[model samples]
Target: MPAFDIQTARFNMIEQQIRPWNVLDSGVLDLLASVRRDEFVPPEHKALAYADLEIPLPGGQYMLTPRVEARLLQDAAVQKTDSVLEIGTGSGFLTALLARRAARVLSLELSPELVAFAKSNLQKAGITNVDVRQGDGSQGAAAQGPFDVIVLGGSVADVPHKLLDQLKIGGRLAAIVGDDPIMRATIITRTSATDFRTSQPWDCDAPRLQNFAQVSRFTF
Candidate 1:
C-alpha cells in the first residue's frame, strides 16, 4: 500500500474535522497547517494523527482530539504578549499550540516520563517557547504566574480556585470541566481583581488531568 499522504490528511483534518466544529480563525487554521501533529504523536499511532479520536499516550493519558484542541485554542484567545500556563502537558501537542500563540508557555506535567517525552517532541517541532516542567500542574504554577492565560489540557471535576487566582486581571482560562458523560468546555475570564465571568462555549470530554480534584461520590 502507498504511504499515507501526510499533507492530504492534515488538510482534511483542518477542513473536514476542524472547520465544521467552528474553528475558523485564520491564524489558528494556518498554525494547524504548519505544525506537524504526526511528529508529536507516538510513532505507533502516527497514522491516526489527524483522526478525530483521542490518541493514547504512555501513562494512560490522552492527546485531545484535533477539534477539541483547536476549539480550546480559539476560546483562550491567546495573545503574542501573553504568558500562558498549561496543565497536563501530555505529548506536548497542546502546549506547542499554546506556545505558538502566546509569548511564552509554562506547561506542567506530573509524569516525569511525559515531561521528557513532551520536551523532546517540542524541541523536535521547533517549539522553543514552551517550558515543559515536571510538577503537579493541578495546583498551577504560582511563582512564574500572574499569567495572562491558563489552559488545562484535560478535564477537571471543577476549575481550581488557586489557578483562577494565579491569573492576571483580564486573563482568561479555558478548561474541560465536569465528570464522565457530561463535560463542558468552559472558559473563565478574570474581568477584574475580584470579578470573573464564566462561559461554556461547547461540550466535550477528555481524560482527566492526574492529581486534580475529583467529586465525592455517595455510597449506596
Candidate 2:
C-alpha cells in the first residue's frame, strides 16, 4: 500500500469537507490546518483522522466530524481573552482548538479513560491552556465558571438551562441539539442577566451526549 500524504489530505479535508460546510472563518481555517488531529485520534482510527467521519472513541462517544467541529468553533466566536468551558472532551482535539482561540479552557469529561487520553494528546501537542477534568459535564462547571464561551462537544436533546446560566452576560454557548439521525448546531447567547437568545446556525448530526436532560413527552 502507498503511504498517505498527510498534508495533502489535510488540505482536502479543509477544502472538500469543512470549507463547503460554511466554515469560512480564516482563524478557524488556520486552526484546522495547524492542529494535528491525527495525534488526538485513537491509535486504531488514526488513518481516519482527516476523513469526514466521526471516528469512534474509547467510550461509545465519537469525535465530532471535522466540519461540525470547525463550525461550532466559528459560531462560538471565541476571543483571545475569553475563558472557555468545554463539555465532553472526547479526544481533546476540539479542546486544543478552543485553547488556541481562548485565553484558557476547562474541559470536563465523564470518562476517566478519555480524560487521560485527552490529557496525553494535549500535552504531546504542547497545548498548555487546557485543563481536562473527569466529571459529569452534563452539569455546568459552576464554581469555576461564568465563562465567556461554552462548547458542548457532542449533541444533546436540548441545551440545559444550567449550562446556559454558566455563560457570562454577552457570552455564547454552542451546542448540537436534537435526536439521532438529525440535529442542528445551535448558539445560545446571554443577552442580559436573565435573557438568552437561541439561534440554529446550521444543521448537523452527532451522537447524543451522555446524561443531558431530554425533552419530556407524553404518551397515551
Candidate 3:
C-alpha cells in the first residue's frame, strides 16, 4: 500500500501545486484524484507519490511531476472513445492514466527493462486497455496509425514531424518543444489534410527523449 495518507494529501496537492498553476479541467483533476500514483512508483518512493516532483525509478528516468502530468492530460482532451499514443512510457504511470481515459492506449518505451517493468506494473494495476511496447518513440506507433491523440512525455528541440503525420484529421498532438533554458509546451492540431495549428500551452522542462533532438553544429 502507499503512504498511510495519500488520499487527503492528493487533494491537498491539487489545491496547492496544480490548481495554482491553472489546471482547471474537472476531468483532469478527477483523474489525478482517482489514480493512485503511489501504486506505480518504486516502492522506496511511494511515500512521496503526491509531491510536486519527479519520482525516480530503477532506471535513470523519473516519473514526471504530477502537475505536468495533469496539465498534459487536460490539454490532450482525451475522450473515452479515443485511441491515444504516448511516447516514453516511464514507470507506466501515464499509460494507466491514458488507459482509463481512452478506449486503448499504445505506449512506447525505448528501454527494454523499463518496458518489462511497465508491463508488470500495468498487470499489477489490472489495466487491460494499455499496450506497452519496447521500441523507439520518435518513430511513433505506426502499426496503430491514425491515432486520435499523440503525446510525448519527454521533450525535443524539434517536434517529430513523422509523428504529427500520423495524426488523423482533427487529431491533436502535445509536446514540450525546445531545449534547456527554453522549453515551451506546445499543442498542434491537424486542422485539415495538410494544415496544422500550433498553440503554446505553457512553459515546461522535461527530459528529452533519446532520439528526438535538434541537429548539433558540426565544426568541420
Candidate that would win on TM-score: 2
For residues 79-153, could you state the per-residue lDDT of candidate 3 as single tens digits? 998999999998998888888899999999999888988898899989999988888898997778899999888
TM-scores of the candidates in the order shown: 0.96, 0.97, 0.94
Q: Which clashing pairs does model 1 show?
A: none
Answer with 2 or 3, whichever has the higher TM-score.
2
Query: Which segments of model 3 are wrong by more than 4 Å?
Result: 1-4, 217-220
How many clashing pairs does model 2 include?
Answer: 0
Query: What RMSD does each model have against the real structure?
Result: 1.6, 1.4, 1.8
Ranking by TM-score: 2, 1, 3
How well does candidate 1 score on lDDT at residue 206? Answer: 90
Candidate 1 whole-model C-alpha lDDT, 0 to 1: 0.92
* Alpha-carbon runs more than 4 Å astray in model 1: 1-4, 217-220
Give the clashing residue pairs of candidate 2, or none: none
Ordered by lDDT, highest first, the candidates read: 2, 1, 3
Q: In candidate 3, what residue range of length 10 has the lowest lDDT sum?
A: 1-10
Q: Please, what are the lDDT tens digits per residue for candidate 1 over residues 59-146?
A: 7989999999999999899999999999999999889999999999999999888999999999998888888899998789899989
